[model samples]
Target: MTFAKIELTASDNAEFSNIGDETLDGLFGSNRTMPAQGITEFYGASGSGKTQIVLHLALFFLTHSNNPRVVYVSTESFFPIKRFRELLQQKLTRDYENGSEKSADKSKTVEEYGNRLLLTHEPSVESLMNCLTVRIPKLVSECDGIKCVIVDSIAAVFRCVRKSEIPYDERSRILFKMAAALKRLSVEKGMSVIVTNQVSDIFPNDVFHVNQRLVADKKPALGLSWSHCVTTRILVSKCDPMSIPVTLPGGKQSQLALRRLHVISSPFCPNSSTFFVVDSNGISSVHENPTL
Candidate 1:
């Protein structure tokens, strides 16, 4: 019911990351009006790039920050290990080209970076709760500079629950308890908690559509119980695919699968959005100097 109180360090409240993208930086950076802590939920339909955005954030802290580590807890059956490694390599390559690294030991650097990222698999709600309440606090105690903890699709755990197996009241309590642990981890531990959530389609006149006053046709899963757990809610969605002309060796064109990230609710700025594309280089903002 309670997590052990850990002594907060001076740097615990220090700012952790700045996404290079202007759209995100304005909201999460030093210029942000809200304190740089608490839980952020990225909810969207499958293939909406929710995992990629969080992965990109984890990598950003790993590469850009002051020796900060990121804990990425994934409930997805298949974690994108190869893709994550590729992104890390690309970021490191860019840094080296920018004259950030003097040593030619790139492989060693990759290994070190890989170690800093603590990746764990929690396939069930019970396992997830244990990881959040027990394992995460242990990690924070043992590891210094653990700037952020990302749970890729926290919805996966609750999505598996059935009324026959777990009663509604029991489920709600579990959800609330999990959320409380996350809040404590964010506020007390002084680290940011990020979670991904799945979305379900809402038909016209649906109960949630009418009674709950949900404006979006596609609503993030976990209902109002888990919704209240998150300090900020962001919707990640896919846009219509468009073509971009490329000056390649044979003048080829590329089909860009654009993605949109909208701040559905936040204390700092609400109803803000930015479009981006994910490629071999990871997630990149589509518009330069995009205004939100």
Candidate 2:
């Protein structure tokens, strides 16, 4: 079988280029989940920082608007505009600290970065799809750039359009419509789709359910159908940094680092998974954690 691989080229001057975090290089020390086309769902409980990671990626594409356009749709209304700006500032500061070439033109660079952010609000799947089908294409055409789409809180789009055993054709129509549109967008436009999802609690053991994501063995809220549609389904959860043990001279010490982890599935990456943390500073590959 033939497989498609991600081909990233290095710059002549040795500048690091990636989708926000450097984890894209070593898969964060494991298999990183990303889809060439179609939807890639990043599932986890609330506070797992799914939106933060996606936002960072979004900004990466946005700031480099000369390269490609990134369209982000938020369903849960949890977008952190202030936080996004703050991260941008931090990134700019880091660039300056590191003697980045662009530091000389900081004012123009900041304006360009701000101008590149093309985020729109869509409260529901229906509203979101409508915008996707109409506004998105035009935006991409005007910018001459359309490479990625981030649908933060993908499951939330179906909040009002709940999963019913009653076989509501109307509801299914909407669901399929959105999915089809997303798929069409990706395949037709050669765009990447990254979605955020919530999980149901059908876990066999409640051992790691302390995060409140696995509630009484309930299955993922969106059902198996949603998982089936996406090109990649990455399960994520928060781990008590303190639970992870590090042996010290005194004894085994625990580090209290809350991390966002991605456990890969078939056709996604590999046997193992990757870990990361989405905090105020933005998404950092767990492997590079200073505490680790």
Candidate 3:
């Protein structure tokens, strides 16, 4: 069989939806998620707030668009339903208090938001692939305004696949096919694809780099093959926790510790970092004045 070369043009008029946090959105250019029809990877250490960011993005996207929907697939079986509800309630309460809306109306809106978010748990690679290739497409077709698809901790799904059982070449081929399927879905469906990855320690060889010193020596998992699948990559890490004074619901003051977010790589934006705190109202920026 013979095939002709294919040429494609990048979308010039692509739109973006905010991830709910200003600092987080600003990491991507113009304070928004990467343009539609692209895959973004968020990788970080444990307790680095990667999942929190994903939940916040879903919340914001659902609220911003008319009849919006999202597909969130969790591989680690760690979806914090309590925390999600708390964040949702906080947002609804803030909007209701700030606007002239009634309490009953806010309750209805909260219910609708809950209904719009569809959650799926995939424990193995086969299940994940099936959901991505089969179930997700069906859900998108049946629902309107599905804006984003997120897979939390993609590394967890494939960590236990033995090389003896499945040869390295076969495993790689499967991963490549999966990546292609994800890319095709993003492009054809015109939706943002986001996936979270865990980090692996990278130690420099003593012989090759004896003089080099390193601080953060961790890198995203799944290696080079998976890297090509992602168009943007953000690395989140915890900085020294700072106790910042915060006002409570009844005008009481308390201290909160905020984590830092770093933008490791992107085609459209330069590398930058920001600080944020996860409170009852979701993630918010922390602005610290420079020390004299």
TM per candidate comes to 0.82, 0.71, 0.82
Counted clashes in each candidate structure: 0, 10, 0
- lDDT of each prediction vs. the true structure? 0.70, 0.57, 0.69
Cα RMSD of all models vs. native, in order, equals: 5.2, 7.8, 6.5
Whole-model lDDT, model 1 = 0.70
Q: Candidate 2 — what's its lDDT? A: 0.57
Over the stretch 1-292, how does candidate 1's per-residue lDDT look in tens digits?
A: 1112223455334344455455555554346433446678888889888888888777766775545677789897667889888988887887678676431245457777777777789999889889988888776666553677888878797777788888888888988988888887777677778889998877766674452234346888877788878887877877653334222222333456767777777765556666776777776666442232
Evaluated at residue 91, the lDDT of candidate 2 is 77
- Give the top-scoring candidate (lDDT): 1
Q: lDDT, candidate 3, residue 12? A: 58
lDDT of 2 at 18: 36
Q: What's the distance in Å from true for residue 169, model 1?
A: 1.4
For residue 216, model 2's alpha carbon misses the true position, in angstroms, by 12
Ranked candidates (lDDT, high to low): 1, 3, 2
Task: Compute the lDDT of residue 53 as modeled in candidate 1.
Answer: 82
Off by over 4 Å in 2: 1-19, 28-35, 64-67, 99-107, 138-143, 161-170, 203-220, 241-256, 266-268, 288-292
Better of 2 and 3 by TM-score: 3
